[model samples]
Target: MNQDLFDNVRRLVTTAAAGLAARRGEGLAEVLERLAQQDIGPGAFREPEPRSLPVLRHLPQCVGEAMVLDPRLASAIASVEDALQWQQSASYTDDLLGAGFSENYGWAEIIGPRGFFPGDDVLLGLLMLGPERHYRDHYHPAPELYWPLTAGSFWSRDGGPFVEQPQGAIIWHPSMALHATITRATPLLALWCWTRDTATPAQLA
Candidate 1:
């Protein structure tokens, strides 16, 4: 394992947790508490081989935009961007979602089964969506939280109308609640978390 890379990711995770600590949102307190208890040090981390996806092409721009909202968070993300293993859900395909969606969307776990630090029934990661894409309604067993670092994104929950969410905004989804995301004009880079009940994957609604 590259100690430098590992240290960078640790800093990123620490920064993320500190940044989230001050923010107030629905279900955020619970998520923060759970995250605070995790052992993210070297003893608990096992780095996976890094990989990436097409959607990462938008990451630079997303990070640039994010700088306007929170430079500390943006810089932290940029510091370890290359070390993350970006992945997509096997169940998501153009046939099920929409054309081009496969190339335009991906996520990377920072703390979970497939991440640098194995987490227990919890996940903390980043999610990206390229421009002009709609991630239609999907539901999972875990309660979720999203903190978008970029702008021009919209979110919908429980089949409701899409509502624009600004940068640094926290979006929460209770367990099994249908939720969707739409990106317009600009791509999205967001921190996402699942607190407990994480065994089941999300299913399209």
Candidate 2:
């Protein structure tokens, strides 16, 4: 494990949490509380082998775009990019999504069962979707929060219409609520967190 990489991830989480301080919402409150309880120090985590996915090919571009919106958060992400364990959902398939969906989507956990730090019931991570992709409706038991680092992304929740969310905007999804995401010409790089009920995985609608 690269001590510097681990520290960078820790800083990323810390920086993100700090930026959310002024946001008001029940979901955000719970996420902050859970994040507060996490110990991200050296002794609190086990190093997982670093990995990458096809979607990451666009990460540098996304991060660069993100810097224009939130330099602090974007730089935090860039600092730890090389050490992330990028992965995709085993249940997701090209047939279920789209022909190129497999190559366009992936996630990396910063805190959770599969993450560097084992968070009991909380999950913190990054989710990336390449250009012009639709991650159709999906639902999960846990409440979720997403802070998109880059722009030009649309999100839909609870069978609602898709709304364009700006860079650094926070999107929350309550437990079991249907949600989906779409990306246009620009790819997406977002920080996400699941406050509780982390046992169940997301199921597509």
Output the number of the lDDT-best candidate. 1
Which stretches of candidate 2 lie above 4 Å from their native place? Answer: 24-26
* Model 1: pairs clashing at backbone N, Cα or C within 3 Å: none
What are the clashing pairs of model 2?
A: none
Q: Which stretches of candidate 1 lie over 4 Å from their true place?
A: none
Q: Give the Cα lDDT of each candidate.
A: 0.91, 0.90
Error of 1 at 182 (Å): 0.6
Count backbone clashes in candidate 1. Answer: 0
Could you tell me the C-alpha RMSD of candidate 1 in Å? 0.9
Q: Give the per-residue lDDT digits (tens) of candidate 1, residues 103-157.
A: 9999999999889889888999999999999999999999999999988899999
Cα lDDT of model 2 by residue, 37-60, tens digit? 988888886777889999999999
TM-scores of all candidate predictions against the true structure: 0.97, 0.95
**The best candidate in terms of TM-score:** 1
Q: TM-score of predicted model 1?
A: 0.97
